[model samples]
Target chain A: MAQNASQLEHFGRALVDLGLINEELVVLDPDVAASTKVTYFAERFPERFIRIGISEQDMIGVAAGLAASGKTPVACGFAMFVACRSWEQISSSVARPELNVKIVGSHSGLSPNADGDSHQTYGDVAVMRVIPDMKVVVPADAPEAVEALGAIVDTPGPAYLRLARGATPVAYTEGCEFTLGRANVMRDGSDASVIANGVMVPIALEAAGSLAREGISVKVVDMHTVKPLDTDAIVKAAAETGAIVTAEEHSVIGGLGSAVAETLVEKRPTPMERVGIMDRFGESSRSYSALMAKMGLTSDAIEEAVRETMRRK
Target chain B: MLRTINKNQVLILTNIPRVPASITSVLRGISRRHKIPLSTLKRNAQILKEFNLIAYGDPPNFSGVELTELGRFISNLTVGEEPTVHGNMVQTRSGFRPLGTVIKDLRKTVLRMIAEAGSGHLGASLSAVDILAILYMIKMKHDPKNPSWKDRDRFVLSKGHAAPALYAVLSEAGYISPDRLMTLREIGSQLQGHPDMEIPGVDASTGSLGQGLSIGVGMALASKMDGSGSRTYVLLGDGELNEGQIWEAALTAAHHGLDNLTAIVDRNGYQLTGRTEEIKAMDPLADKWRSFGWEAMEADGNDPASILDALNACDLTTGKPSVIIAMTTKGKGISFMEGNKYSRKTPDAQELKRALKELT
Candidate 1:
């Protein structure tokens, strides 16, 4: 299967088109109208949607109340508050009780290249992963975003749906199947598994492609659900692939790398290297690629890291 | 498992001196019927008993409820004091307050709570203390003893950082035990240095600065959807006003015409880093409310009496939600803390001891 139309609007339109979600699904936000690109959904279902100005905390609180009363609320806000400011409510009111609220945190994980370090989310994944029973899904590109949204039609419990800014390159094929906590093996190889999520998915996939030419068949796993790290896949990859590399656009402390390593170390120890921001705030001026490269997030970096892990193999 | 306030006396309303001649036989007839369940009859007999329009029988099979002299008194009063010619009126025994001395107590409790904790948001708490005090004390009909009492008024501390004052007032009002006041900010305590509804007095756990009011608005709308008359009140910090979410809630409140909702903005002139003007200035504050279609009012937050009066007055507005901008002094007591620009600094114990010297 392949996933296409890598845009948030595409996902939103699919939600309405599939009727898997009610048109009554709301969009409550804290002032990121243009960034998440929900204007089209807002236009079609104005009554169902709301631009909740800039009160991120109240937006989540009110959304929780609305969710309690049976209306599905898709609260949109900056990744920081959707992760930080209203952190308690997300943990207590929404996730603790297992309320059916979908928190759409757009511009997540260093998506704000120019908005400066203040807007960049260095560790959005870690903040949410600690919340018990939370289902965190970080889409690799617009295609995966659409698939994740379409996939959660009947899914339950509190979920963190992380989306990035536009110009995201497509990484998955049309009709690509997305599952919660289950990693999809994008590439099959025994040399190593370059497990990746969010914007780094394509980077890892591209690295695998580059390595393939050099006769190093690297298995790429798009580990979208970072919290419940796909242990079965990582364990299997380690058992068969002999080596691994994990990458993300988040702090190395509690992001995808930690999630993968925790699983592998307990189940099956595999030589691995994590490619991410290491104890540093993000740079504001650099383009997405330049910033990622500077922070050692390039496909070249993943290839090199994978090569280093292969040495252990 | 919960013991109610002791019903030692029966309050008799005797203004309707006698039973009408037409209802006399009905009263006599009710007095002869001994098999009726008491709770069902008590709810229906309020007005009838007040006017002597109805009377109670000797005794029922249920041994749980006893008949007393007060019960006899309640059986004779008429229920027409509600000033309506309607067929019937359902009134709660513990209904809404009318704004007065109760607010004064609520306000005082907030201050006392802060002083007890020795660490808190004095500026925001002082800013909202009076309005919130008025609400718990005079405006809302709530059971402090049973904070989760079904159908009771809902109060949300949206500007959550002001939990110290809120906890203080709730404890003073008997919603929380006075003993728990000392446990604030301590590890494993229900008082988590913020408003946690898991705590007896709090309705929503808020401390992230700008999230409580919307929860209040949702609770308000929920009550309305159920067609229940329970009102919801929320207190928001002025610093929280800068968060765009407040406006979203404000607009949503107006769109719904949540007449059962009342919001109080603690319009003190300070935030965490600096004075509101130096941080993010919001002038024409009242005009902004007016544009949002909310019936806005300005009141002195420190003056208990005025705050009580203003909250009571909110009900007079025709078909709209209201926001009361309470003008207050930051760090408003114990002269040294009063108007203290550095609102967040922990006053030295020796310095605080010095500040309290004038208290006696």
Candidate 2:
């Protein structure tokens, strides 16, 4: 877990482990087995792996059907397509009746940088969070992704796990407990707080360290679960820190920023700033870091948002 | 009412008081009791006779309406007793019933239940009744008492408007009570407007079109993975073929060599707006399935025996999925409802009475 690794690889290994433990486990992919990392599962359990060939709608429907037949289906697809193409199926067939279908969306956020804007998904969290009975989880790194995959399988309803495209900075040195609808505070401070999800968690931690060195201590909270947003942690962070800044690799419109704002406005209002893509689509970038910089998703942006929130406070 | 409940029976209701209850006498009694005209009742009775309920003799002959023994039994059957709707003597040791008899019983139950619900997809229900009957009673290996049996064959009704048909068939197979059939779309009822998995014997929940085939594929894949001999059957509407997801599922099933999966398209010709031809002409449907790598065949959807035969004849050894293009008529048994513009609408009291008569 200390080494940077592909979240998709962790997902694939988790699926195989889940299949070995539970005989009712089935995996589905929409022609991205290699990229989504379900190839490992398919190789280990060939009979339980189903490849639907780039049809997200069919894959979701099949997953729902398999879940109805008492099999827990872990469907893998690109975040850009699965969150948009088969949203209706995911809503009607799976979430509506609350089936036990786990959706692992690889290439989440701007991680699929080289594939251009069309491949990079920045609205998956927004779309998936709005669906009723859907549990949305954004792991901090590969270790959390594996833990979240196991948690999703154990949870009894529809769940969506947003995964990164390539190797992400490891945030945990060992496998840690990942409970659905819970947040883990990585650093504690009373000056200001930086709440982030997915790939932004490691950057937020770095920003917290930078703020600490500058004598402006900031708390860092990894709010991986987005749907059942950790309202308790958000409120606690606001009350303790007196200021808050939210960062995510997704758009600021309806992603982590909006979720934190919505929670704070009702429970504990606090001065806040959001760090994400403001209001435009992504463009082709040479590297993930380049896209992160272009979209203002770096640790510097989080530090700037925290400074802005502190000045407002 | 009793004769309508049992299509093969002929019991008459009259307004006139008499010793032996005749068809005209029963009509006279009803007219007198309801304070309506004997002429009006006579007209309604004439309509019933045209529905083939009452065999007519010469005019003015009170003996024209014949009361068969079956009709008498139907009229006298009470709620507490075990009732037989159709006259039969043979009891199969293997519990196999004649498909024709099952179809008739299923039709009778569906017509009565839909009429009781007062609002349902009558045309689609009637159109798919025979197919469901064949699947549940003849073709599929299912145990009604043990709905969750691991090795049982699965059926998903992608064309969920025919839920009444499935409910009636499930009732006949003892998965549901005959009395529960009347609560078709009521709140908190196990039988929903579409096939919900909460209902016993319903393998999956489906109402939105083109989703059942994928579910069937999933079940087939799961069964194959489990090394079970169970098969999966999906019933689809012809109009539902317009959905792109169906073809996606078709490709998946074929690519996976899901030979245990079988799909049946109920080509009932009509959809909500108009005929399938006018909406979307899917004429080369069998060839399309074949091109998609399935063993495709066509059968008379209204004939349960033919459906069973076609289902049996499907080649699962070909390492491809099987599809049956079942040519059926919307509103199959009811004469006035067949291909009518208002076929999907619920029948009024008079229409229900007419349908019941024809069904009897």
Model 1: per-residue Cα lDDT over B33-141, one tens digit each:
4334444335444444444433444244222122223432332222212232121111112322222334343444454555566777766665666566546543465
lDDT of 1 at A220: 89
**lDDT tens digits, residues B1-360, model 2?**
543443212223211111223565555645554566778766766655565544445456656353232322222232102233122111122233444566666777777777787777888889898888767654566667678888788999999888999888877777887778889888889887887877888888889888888888888887887788788999999999999999999999999898889999999898889988888888899999999999999999986546765776663345989999999999898888888444568777888788878876
Highest TM-score among the candidates is held by which one? 2
Error of 1 at A121 (Å): 7.2
What would the per-residue lDDT of candidate 2 be over residues A164-196, giving only the tens digit for each residue? 999999887557878888999998999999999
Q: Calculate model 2's interface RMSD in Å.
A: 1.3
Which CAPRI level is candidate 2? acceptable
lDDT of 1 by residue, A187-305 (tens): 89989989899888888888988999999999988898875667888899898889989889888898888988888888998899999888798878558767776777788889999
Choose the strongest candidate by DockQ: 2
Off by over 4 Å in 2: A1-3, B1-102, B108-118, B315-317
